[model samples]
Target: MRLMPDEHQVRSLDHQWQLGNTRGQMRTWGRGQFRWTTFDLSVERGPDGKRRIKKTTLTDTADLKNPLRDAVLAMGWSWRARLSKL
Candidate 1:
C-alpha cells in the first residue's frame, strides 16, 4: 500500500488501506441493483481527537470503484451538522 494522508488525521490513511485483503467480497446496492462487493476500510483516531474515518468500510472489491461517495458525503455533512452544536 502506498503511504498517504487523511486531511483530518494529519496522518496517513494509506496505512489503513492495503493491497492485500482486497479479496473480501460482499454486496453492493445501487439504483435498485445489488451485486457482490468487498470491504476495505478501518476506523481509527485522527489528530482531531475524534473518530477519523479512512473510508471505514469497503472501498472497491470486484475490481470496480466504490460508488457510494454521495451517500457518504451526505452522512459526513450530517455528522458535521450534529457536531456543529457542540
Candidate 2:
C-alpha cells in the first residue's frame, strides 16, 4: 500500500508516543475527488530504542478502533492527543 508523505504520532506499547505509519490506497471517484480509505496504523521499535515503521503489503482486516482503545488501556495514553485532521 502507498502511504501519505506525513505520519502522525501515536502512543504504543511503550507508553511513549511515536509515529504511526498509515497504509492505504488513493482512489479517484465522483468528479475527480481523491481519497484514501481503509487505512491502518502500524508502529515499530528499532534497536536504538527509537520507534520506526517499515512498510508491509498485508493489511489487517480487524477494526482499528479496538486496537486504538487497547493501546490507550495498555499504555494510559489518549489516542486523540496526537491525532491529525486526516
- Model 1 C-alpha lDDT per residue in residues 37-80, reported as the tens digit of each score: 56566678888888865753454432431333234445442112
Q: What does candidate 2's lDDT look like per residue over 1-86, in tens digits?
A: 11222443343221222343465345322321122234445788889999987665454423544666566557644443322233
Candidate 1: segments with Cα more than 4 A from true spot: 1-35, 56-86
RMSD of every candidate to native, in Å, equals 18.7, 17.7
In terms of TM-score, how similar is model 2 to the real structure?
0.22
Q: For model 2, name the residue pairs that clash.
A: none
Clashes of each: 3, 0
lDDT per prediction?
A: 0.35, 0.42
In candidate 1, list every pair of residues with a backbone clash. Answer: 26-37, 39-58, 40-58
TM of each candidate vs. truth? 0.22, 0.22
